[model samples]
Target: MSQTKLTPPGPKGNFLLGNLQEFQSNPLKFLLNLRKEYGDFVQFRLGPFQKFYFINDPELIKEVLVTKQKSFIKSEDIQTLKTVVGEGLLTSEKEFHRRQRKLIQPSFKRSNILSYGEDMINTTLNYIFKWKNGEERLISEDMLNITLGIISKTMFNMEFKEGADVIGEPMEAVMKLGIKRMRKIVKLPLWVPTKQNRKLKKAIHALDDVLNEIIKKRRACNEKHEDLLGVLMDAKDETDDTHMSDKQLKDELMTIFLAGHETTANALTWTLYLLATHPEVDTKLFDELNNVVGSSLPKPEHFSRLLYTQNIVWEALRLYPPAYVIGREVDEDVVIGDYSLKKGDTVMISQYVMHRDETYFKDPTKFVPERFENDFMKTLPTYAFFPFGGGPRVCIGNHFALMEIVLVLACIVQQYQVTLPDDHHDVKPQPLITLRPKHGISLLIKDR
Candidate 1:
């Protein structure tokens, strides 16, 4: 006789909406509270039919993302994202994703990424140099703009400073609308003329127009450029000898455009906020920068020697991960740990929740950059500190993002002292498609 496995205990809600209202009101708090009350593997409902399992245990998360990853696929939110990004690497699946990854892998090679360091530093310097000493600015927007400029110049061999508004405004609208679509139980077709639907379409169109123009110009150019766009355009499959179509190029470019800058921007914003609030950490960081680079611009060779600088970024990521949650849906009936999950069931793993778990770090709620010193990462489970995610599907731009964050921070902090305004209030993390600062981070800047 076979033994029976009962569903894990979870918060019981009314028969109809079952946990949907609670989740939508505040997702981060709901998940944190759920873990505190229901333990590691808790099963809950979203709508009338959708089943969700929240996994806080590191081993179970590993199973879902790595060991038995084939049994699951991206969750519904990612499927929702395809409306904006098309079938790019972030939303693609199976063999197609593997193929695209292979074709695009070389552009992120160690040597290739090192070459982009100069552009990253120069872009940071140029943007920050314009800031008048003792001026107050929304550091969040500055981080976003500088990162957008860096990604554009390094990847596409083009400057985005003049067109920043063209991309920035519409991109914000798209991300806001994307989150709304993900949470709604009844999604209307894009063809429908509802106000939200029309707005989404308009935002997406604005983005499409900008990207399509770039793709068109790149295709028309005859020079064999060495940048990421050039590499993508010229790459040929080993077996088929076929290059990416314009549509495919646009999809990948859109994916990179959003992922390359937005997440890193948030990371840096949080980092600056953390540094502003914690003066001791900020002082140590400045000390490291002064000793390592010594009144010169940050270069690729200086990256490895800046251990404290890297730890500060790592700590920021641990606290406020840009992609706070990773969701997956079961592709087929599978068993994770002792739980029996049926096909169509969704699994949620939150880096925000996990990074703060007391089991992994001492004084989990506090900001302590020194926690990452002395090989602290090696002691934790792989999934416990997964800011870039894990498995074959881990972020392809992890290396690029890390290098950019460290270099940009080095450049700016060495030149300016970033401190919160005297009237600065606490900054709250806004849980969207990517985690961002609510309202925005306002800071006082002065020449160091």
Candidate 2:
């Protein structure tokens, strides 16, 4: 085993659980404060089983996630997600992940995603019909429904009215259970006969049923379409193999469905909420959008045209990053900066903290979209603003998510003005799978 100093310049951790308690309470805030107190490197123990070296240094983070990626593996916490996502790209082994990523890559081509633009526009308009004039809509739920619909329509050509709530109910249950487990309020495994375990099983079954039915219908059809499922059905591997098995297809489809909607929906929701509260930003964005797309729906061609609007999206992602934290484990003893971590030691790159690092960003707390206009943004260090993560395992549906967010934002802005019902309510972020508003942001939507 390699040995190096374990010393870090920070408050010593608690003897029992180290800093796990504070971490569990409000992880995003805790890490932000911890980084403030500890500087770039902090060491803590996760229970008595493992040690974690939280590295806030950008260079060191790049080394682990990019340059020295082969020396590390997805952390144990990520491994726990295998039950939910299966051995899909997100939680699979290095070789398996590589193979799956290669296989699934063609499904997310720009052309394929562009073909789904009409579906996205139609879905957004469908949701707009549900909004009552001057009704207080929980923007969180509204955004969830919108993204869920978009994912269903674009990915599988399913109708939002017919499909979203059905798939969403189980997903919500699974997410609630998952968050509870992550918080350690419940400690039962999947095989256990407890209530949470049972609910997890049921949720899994419900989602499986929905995906299986969709898959079956697609398979039975004679002709092919340009949606995500069609691309997956046509994807070819290295050995000239074509087609994913029913089981593989189901797992990947469900993974994309949940991940596709949940993360992007939370991001768009936060973006709108932020814009609603900040009138100057809102008006600036409105002017930009009006100039770019006029009174029409957004298209792939308009993405580059709305440069300022895109910057606002980037800034919002930095402030309330959907993929809050990414973790990895040292496969062998290694030195990161001045700290040494043993094999099996886990490390977290908290984007919540990293994005807010005052050293990297001026006035880190402010939402200034213009910062992205700097030439250095294209050359910014890795993990500095990795809302979608970094390196090989970066989110595959990134372009799709971006396209959806821009289109959805454009659609909503064209029809309604959003404002928080109560201006003084605390708008804290709660980090689960994605960083979401702790309490739902209730907004009154006035027709434009």
Computed on alpha carbons, the lDDT of every model, listed in order, comes to 0.89, 0.80
* Candidate that would win on TM-score: 1
- As a whole number from 0 to 100, the lDDT of residue 109 in candidate 2 is 76
Candidate 1 root-mean-square deviation in Å: 1.9
Model 1: per-residue Cα lDDT at residue 413: 92
Report the lDDT tens digits of candidate 2 across residue range 235-299. 87868666678888887877787678878888988899888888898888888878888887766
Runs of candidate 1 with Cα error greater than 4 angstroms are 1-4, 163-173
What TM-score would candidate 1 get against the native?
0.95
lDDT for 210 in candidate 1 is 81
lDDT tens per residue, model 1, 251-277? 898888878788999999999999988
